[model samples]
Target: MDYIIDVKELRKEFTSHSSRSGLKGAFRDLFTRNYTIKTAVDDISLQIKKGEMVGYIGENGAGKSTTIKMLTGILTPTSGHVRVNGMNPHKDREQFVRSIGVVFGQRSQLWWDIAVQESFRLLKKVYNVPDEFYNTHMADVIETLAIEPLLDKPVRKLSLGQRMRCELAAALIHNPPLLFLDEPTIGLDVLVKLKIREFLKEINAKYGTTILLTTHDLSDIEALCERVIMLDEGKIIYDGALRQLRENWGEGKQIQFSFAEEATHAELQSLTHDHLVVWDQGSNASNWTASVENNEDIISAVIGQVVGAKKIADLKIVEITTEEIIRNIYEEGAVRNG
Candidate 1:
């Protein structure tokens, strides 16, 4: 496989100091300094092939942003190395940046007060994009991302979802081969979220753009990335196929069913393990839900005990979600132990 991103032993750290607010404390802190070495990124390595969409996930201070900054040449690593497109990003920033695009969801790359199209025009001049290439690329992106209606609107006047579409289009104006998305779908409705996911998939399939996405939304990881890299306390805890992560650390598989009439909690308890997990009583209390670990030894037995042809109105098996997987990893420390 041709690797687009090759990182080895990458580490980053920052010096945190106690800053005093008042004059006395400020003077005291200035003379008697107190600081601590905070490791924002630990010794971590990863290889991503061209066209691969990988999820980089962690808690707020877990070094996700630190890794991104290093990759994008915004911050220098304390140690280790990173090569994007076989070139040192920090050393060859100008050339490397031309081949990659980054979208920081919290910050707008587009000018705030200007029209969206004006911002794109400015970026074209900054990136030195040729007239033919710029026009063609922008046209394609506008059509694909459905940003035509947003072109004339000032960025400040657009809704979050609309602005995000414009942001994506702006990132692709240069037609970079690599894209870095940081919480691109943080605040959006279900329909808009689905549209963004579909658009990303289209881009990956059509252009083979390698994407590294950092997001709190687990569904983004689930829908887009086949491989997920999980970070905890600046160290990579899990790096593998999403399916493998689910099978290994996911709590269990859920089996939901609806019945003809209300079923007693006691009767439901009789159907599963001694420690049963079920959430049934809604407006329609007749429906029952239960989940159990999907293991070879008891899967069939569990299914048989839970489902009967007529008793169950509907039955389906759902693998544990990425959200649940991460939740379990944090709360129980199961994945870390393994």
Candidate 2:
């Protein structure tokens, strides 16, 4: 199979320098230096197929940015190998970049003082995009992102959400087969985020553009990616389907029941020994909450036990969130290491 991205034992390292503070020590430090070697990316390997949207997620300082930089030819790896589209990104940077588009949420790639359209035109000249292709692509992007109204406005004057929309459009003008999106929805309102998500889905389906998305938002993963790669301390801890991650690591459902008649603590305890039940006074003195596995049999058994003793007025069951499952994995790893 031909993979768009193939990484083998990729590693990146950095050096930190420290100097003495006092004048005498400073003078001595001029002659002697202390350096500490930090590994930002450990030996990691990954393969992504053409047109596949993969979520690359991790906590801060987990080497997500470092790996992206290497893939985009902005940073050189210390050791090992990386190949994108059958080419070494760092070795043939000029050619490699023409095949890929990148967006950094906190950084602006547009000219601050220029109109959004002018920025698009400038990118067209820089990338040498043909007139026919440019016109069609820009039109599609403008309509999809709803940026027609903001075309004449300067990049510096647009709101965060508007600027992000333009940023995405600018990156897509060349119609690169691969796209790297780093926190593309950061700092946007709910409505704007939804628009952006919709645009991404449309583009991926229409063009089959392969995407590698990195974000702190787990919802983005749930909405966009079927496969996820989770990193920790410069290493990948999990790489599989999103559903499998939930099945393997996710905590089960949390169920709450509102009873018409108050049941004593002893009565509740006698009903089930498998679940942890707590009286919720804020909702109602008779309401109770239980933490239980997501198994149908277990849930049915618990429900039967409760209904047998008390009349249930209302009930709600909430499944565990992706954030909670990832957090639990990190905490468990820490505990085991300690």
Candidate 3:
């Protein structure tokens, strides 16, 4: 299994000038200025095998964009190395450019004044794609993405969903083996987001294109990516299977129950072991939630011990979501180096 993307000890920093305050401070700036160095991306390393769709997630200012920029050859790393498809992206600019595609949802790659088809045509020329291959691939993309009706419409006239589909088509027209998607579904409705997810999954399955995605929408991560790498404060805090991350960060189980009659808080608290009652529905309704340790194994036993079939009306138990798990990891305690 060959790795298409390899990164090692990548680091990036930015120096921002301090703003002058008041007249004295402004005049003092003429003589000297102060600057603060912000570590945007600390030393980080990872390898992505070919045909792998990875979800790269992190909080704001967590260096997600900085890492993307380095991987896409948009910015040179202050330190360390990055190799995509056996080429140094920054050094072999032409070769790298031809072998990859990028789409930033906040920005448009299509010409605003031209019809979607025309922009794709221009891309065909730019990538120097053969006419036969271009036609075949374009037809397939249009059909798969369901952009046939919007192809002839100018980009500016298309709805956000329509434009996103076109944008995806444009990025792949050249048939780059690797795709870098930055928030491809940002600000879209639920239906649109689902549509985009389906399209991306289809392309990856059909073409085996290696995809590196950076997104805030955890649903996108859950829906598309098999592996996830989490970053915080410019460092790789968690990296591995999404399941493992959830197992470690998430409490074992969330147990909820509704009784036919009100139950005392003391009785509920007494049933818990290491777990704590993070939320309670109150005695009036006989509903409550408790964070139980060894949740999976102990929950039922505790329920039996505590409730004792006290005419419970409803009961629900399930594993926590990715969002809740990640939140727990971040909020658990002091940040540790990884």
Candidate 4:
């Protein structure tokens, strides 16, 4: 099988010069430089096949950006090998970039002073896109992202949400096979986020585009990616199905119950000391909650008993979120070292 991305024992390090803040230290530093070496990516190996939407997640300084930079041909690896589209990103940069599209949430790829449509036209020429394909692809993205109205507006004049929509369109102008997204929805409103998410799904389904998404927002990961690769301290700590990660790392789950209005306080008072506890809301004794330890039959048993005791209005079993699970792993040093 031909993989879109293949990395083996990849490592990157940076050396910085430092000195003590004093007249004598400054004089000593000038003659003999003191250098500190820090590793950004350390001995990692991974592969991404075509048409896979994988989530690459981690806290700040976890080397997520560094790895992406190396993959995009923006930075060279210090050691090991990286093959993106069957070529070395650094050695074959110009050719490598044509096979991939990258969107940095904090940065703009478009000419800031230029109209959105003008920027798109320039990109078409830069990528040497055929006029037929450009017209067809541009229409698809514009309709999906709803950015045709903003097409005449300069990039500097668009709002954050509108600009993000345009940014995505810009990246997809050439319809590259592999796309890399870094915090694609960092600070967008809910409606804008939904639009972007749906648009990505359509792109992947329509063209089989492989996506590697990096974001601080777990919702994006939960919504788009099936497989997740988590990094910490420059090393991969977890990489597998998102569902499996939740099952293994999640602390627990909560089962919330809502009773009928007619249920008296005395009728539900026993539940507080029993398996479930009452969350006193105003004068109503309706809302109740229970904590189920991990995945077990105890949840079923709890529900059975609750059903027998009261007129159930609503019942919801809430699983622990991905963010909470990740936090617990980091706090407890439960790194997978994948």
Candidate 5:
């Protein structure tokens, strides 16, 4: 019944000014201002329970960053209400911030000229972390993230991967229960990305740390989050389990079959529904491939038809990937908008 984050009718608006072009128009516009009101977040309401790992995702200009800024107290909402740990984040910034940690992948909180360890010490003083708590947390973080080797190196000299590890440690030094990760694995190689994902999983499992992750990487969402909230043009279009999202919007599973003898296109067409079969071609005289929808009944029917007519050599079914599902959703949105 307890929620770490609660938002109701949350909205953020900004006024942008436009200037006239050309010398004469610019001179005339100097005495006048043209301002337009843009809404960055539009009446969104969501609740995140304790220990929940939620993915906040959207395309560019979808207002993902705006929502996170409001939740973290960096920007105040223009209207509506937001509560983190039962306190208004913007109104009670000091006390509220202690309960949450934020990491901006494109930015650094550590001093550029200082060693990673020195930054941790400075954060200790700033957050007033107890010596025992700091030591215990740091030990766990260092081991989990493998940042021991990079401790003595200046933050500016560390590689992107190493610096990201240090950034995660700096955020966790206070042992905050909630974490907001904005593109935590951006620009990292595959190996480094896997390590970061593993580290996040470990922390969530060990500490039950609630995390709200925003990223362009669908892989991160698939690996780390059970539930997802998708945004489009400052509005939420989907909010539910990852599996459910796929079921609702995903292209069905792809079924591939190889036959003992080559089946002509007309012969294959006679076996299954025309729309259900996607690819119908043979690599050689005895090899052929075909695709079908994911429905069990459909698959069964297609298999029955094909097996009844010819000898089957091989069969494989490929499930729709998370990335493919998301792309479908985006394309659907674009079509609808257009």
Candidate 6:
């Protein structure tokens, strides 16, 4: 009903020029131009309600960054419409930006030569943040991100993890209702990643900030987002709850069982018929694996039957991960097109 970000049939295209490599071909190309038009985003439609943390994910060159740029008003759409926080992001850039915050991991937004605290104060003044609110928020942010040690140092002198901590604190100084994050935890160590994730969770819970994150890290999605929108080759391929995506696109359960003795030929056939044995013992006769149907009840039934009939020696249940699910989707998409 109340949506903070709305897009309808959104599309963006870019025109690029290409020329031949050799000098002779270059001379011939002087009178002619080879222009190519590529669509960066194609017929994208999405809506995000307030306070919803969603992951916008895809492989490199999949148009995730282009969509973020359009949503943030850095680039205008080639066609269709985009609205954020009840205003046209491109047309109302000045007023629209006041309601949103952006952080790109590979770029620095803070003042390079100034101390972190100085940059924070400047942002406070720029955003017209009330002194009372700024003071209260600064205290909480400093403690939550543990950036107090880095505040006195110049932004250019801080390490990546320290700078990222300060960058997050700087983004929150304005208290924007909507935040756009592009690979916020990229290239950081595991400990720093954990700290940043915790900080993001607290910010979302405390300020009700709507976050649209684009990342190659599926772990970030698993920890932070319940919903996911997957893009591929300039088109939206999947959008749904994370759990539902896992259930619908997953490879189901795979388990390997090594028995002290093999089951009878009829017993093995019966199991294979219903269970879909993915790997079976030929010469070994005592080792095999089954990729059961993607149903809990079926898995339970098969496992119970195995325990009763076969003398179990070793068993392994392969765990399904979010990364594997996404990889499967991409592979399937490739097959569909090829």
Question: What's the lDDT for all of these models?
Answer: 0.85, 0.89, 0.84, 0.87, 0.87, 0.86
Off by over 4 Å in 6: 256-292, 295-315, 334-338
Candidate 3 — worst ten consecutive residues by lDDT sum?
273-282
Model 1, poorest ten-residue lDDT window? Answer: 273-282
Q: In model 2, how large is the Cα lDDT of residue 332?
A: 84
Across 160-231, the per-residue lDDT of candidate 4 in tens digits comes to 999999999999988999999999999999999999999999999999999999999999999999999999
Model 1 lDDT, full chain set: 0.85
RMSD (Cα, Å) for all candidates, in order, is: 4.2, 4.4, 3.4, 5.3, 5.0, 5.3
Candidate number achieving the greatest TM-score relative to the actual structure: 3
TM-score of each: 0.83, 0.86, 0.87, 0.84, 0.84, 0.83
Q: Give the TM-score of candidate 5.
A: 0.84
TM-score preference between candidates 2 and 4, better one:
2
Model 2, span 75-161: residue lDDT tens: 999998899978899999989988999999999899999899999999999899999999988899999899999999999999999
* Residues 81-115, model 5: lDDT tens digits: 89997899899999988888899999999999989
Winner on lDDT (2 vs 4)? 2
What is the overall TM-score of model 6 with all chains considered together?
0.83
The local lDDT score (0 to 100) that residue 317 gets in candidate 2 is 82
The pairs that clash in candidate 1 are none
Which pairs of residues have clashing backbones in candidate 2? none
Clashing pairs in 4: none
Off by over 4 Å in 2: 20-27, 256-290, 296-315, 334-338
Candidate 3, 61-146: lDDT as tens digits: 89999898888888899999899999998999888999998989888999999898899989999999999999898898889888
Q: What value does the lDDT take at residue 193 in candidate 5?
A: 90
Model 6 — which ten-residue stretch has the worst lDDT? 329-338
